[model samples]
Target: MREIIAETNRLQLCVPTMDDLDGLSALWSDAETMRYIGSGVPWTREQVQERIERAIGFCADKGMTFWTVVEESTDTIIGQGGLVPISFNGDEIELGYRLGKDHWGKGYATEIARASAAYGFDALNLDRLVAVCYEQNLPSRAVLKKVGFRKLGQSDVYYGVHALLHECLPYDLVR
Candidate 1:
C-alpha cells in the first residue's frame, strides 16, 4: 500500500514501495539528474532497489524517509523528497529533494522543500532541520533560501564531498 505523507497543488509525497523501483531507477540513472547528488554519478537499478528497501525500513522504524514524489495529475513518480537522518551525523534530520530533469525550473523543488520542512516540524515534531547541497548547485541553494534555511557556509560534514550547509527551525520557515 502506498502511504501518502504530504501533498501540494500538483504533487503528493508518499512512502516509497517496491513498485516505485522502475520510476526511481529511471530518475536516479539520468546523469544530468544525478549531477548534484552523491558522488555526482547515476545509480544502478540494484542501487535503486536497495534504496527503496532502506526507505521502507526507515519509514517503519523512524516514521520518515526520502519519499516518492508523485505527480498528482498523471499519477507518475517524478522524484523523491522528504526528511531523513543525516547519514554522517545521526543526531540531525535533513530535508532534501530531487526531481527528474523535466521537472526542473517548475517550482517543484520549493514546494517539496516546503512540504518536507512542514512534515519535519509538524508530523515528526522535529525542532530543527538541516540541508546541504553541492556548492555549484545554485538552484538548490535558492530553494533552500526561499524556504527559510539560513546558510551556515561550506562544510564537508554530511556527504563526503564539500557542500554548502544550511539550517532551519520551525519559526524560521517563510510560510
Candidate 2:
C-alpha cells in the first residue's frame, strides 16, 4: 500500500498509523463531527478500530486511503481526508473527510478536497472521481463545488435526505 505524503502550502497529508488511534477515535467520537454521520451517534472504540482497519486495507488493496490531515508546522492532525474506493454508477474512488470542530470554517476542507481529487486523477490515473455528501451538509457541498466537482445527481438513501452525488473528471482538469 502506498502511504502518499502529500504536501500542500500549509498541510501534510498521510495515512493513519497506530499512533493516530487516540486522535482519530476522539475526533470521530465527538458529537459534532458525527452529526451527519449516523445521526450524531458517538462511534464506539470498536467502530473506530474497524474504520482504521478499513482505511489501512484500502492502502493494501487500492494503494490509497483516507489519510490524516495535518498542519505542516504544528504537525497536528486537524482532520482526515482522502480518495477511497466506492461504488455509485459503478466502481469509483470517493472523497471523504472529517475535520475537528476547532478546525472548521477555514477552507481546509476545500483545500484538501481539491488536492485529494487531484491525487486521484494524477497519481491513481482515474478518469473520474466522485463524492457523496448528506443533503444537509452545506459545508461539504460547498467544498465539493469549490474543488470544481459538478453535481451529476442525487440519491435517496438514509431515509430520503438525498445524498448529493458529485464528480471530478479528467476533462475538467484540462480547463
Candidate 3:
C-alpha cells in the first residue's frame, strides 16, 4: 500500500508491473528455476498477468510484495528479490529471490536481500524475517547466510530438494 522502492548499491527495487509479464513468464518458465518451486506446468502469459495482479494486490493489502530488481546503470530487470507470504508457516513473511543465470555469483541476492530485510524490520516492523530455501540451493543458502539470516533448521516443504528454514531478527541484524 505504501509504494515501496528501495535502492541498493547496484540495484533499484520496485513493484512488479504489467510490463514485466514477459520477464516473469520467462523467468518462471525455466525448469531449473521452478525445479524447487511446485509449478506443475510452466506459467503462460495469462498466468503471468494474473501473477502481476496478485502481486499488486498483495502490496495493496500487506503494503509489500515481490519487487523488481533492476540494474542501476542500465535499468535492466535482471531478476526479482522480495518478501512474500508463507501461509503455512504461521502466515510468516519470507524472503525470495531469483536472478538470470548471468547474474549468479555477483552477490546481487545478498545485496537486495539485505535491503529487503532492513525494510521489513525498520519500515514494516515485522517480528521476524525468514527465508525457505531448497536444500540443494547452496547459492541461495549462501546469500541468506551472508545477509544476516540463520538456518533455523529444516521444514517439510513440498517444493524443493529440501527446505531449510532461515530467519533473522531486528535485534540480531548480522550473522
Question: What TM-score against the true fold does each predicted structure earn?
Answer: 0.97, 0.88, 0.87
**In model 3, how large is the Cα lDDT of residue 163?**
77
- Compose the digit string of candidate 1's lDDT tens values, residues 6-111: 9998999998999999999988999999998999999999999999999999999999999999989989899999999976687899999999998899999899
Off by over 4 Å in 2: 1-4, 87-89, 157-161, 173-175
Task: List the RMSD of every prediction in angstroms.
Answer: 1.0, 2.8, 2.8
C-alpha-based local distance difference test score of model 1: 0.92
Count clashes in each candidate, considering only residues at least 3 apart in sequence or on different chains.
Answer: 0, 0, 1
Which one wins on TM-score?
1
Residue 5 CA error for candidate 3 (Å)?
1.0
Candidate 2 colliding pairs? none
Task: Return the TM-score for candidate 2, rounded to 2 decimals.
Answer: 0.88
Per-model lDDT:
0.92, 0.78, 0.77
Q: Candidate 3, residues 1-175: lDDT per residue as tens digits?
A: 2233898889888888877777677777766766655443556678768878988888778877878778888867778788888766686888888776667788888888988888888889898978887778888888887787888788766244357888888876652
lDDT tens readout by residue for model 2, 1-175: 3244687777778877766778777788788788876456878878878888887788778878988788777777787898887643457777887798888998788778877777888888989887788878999988888778889888664234568878888766422
State model 3's lDDT: 0.77
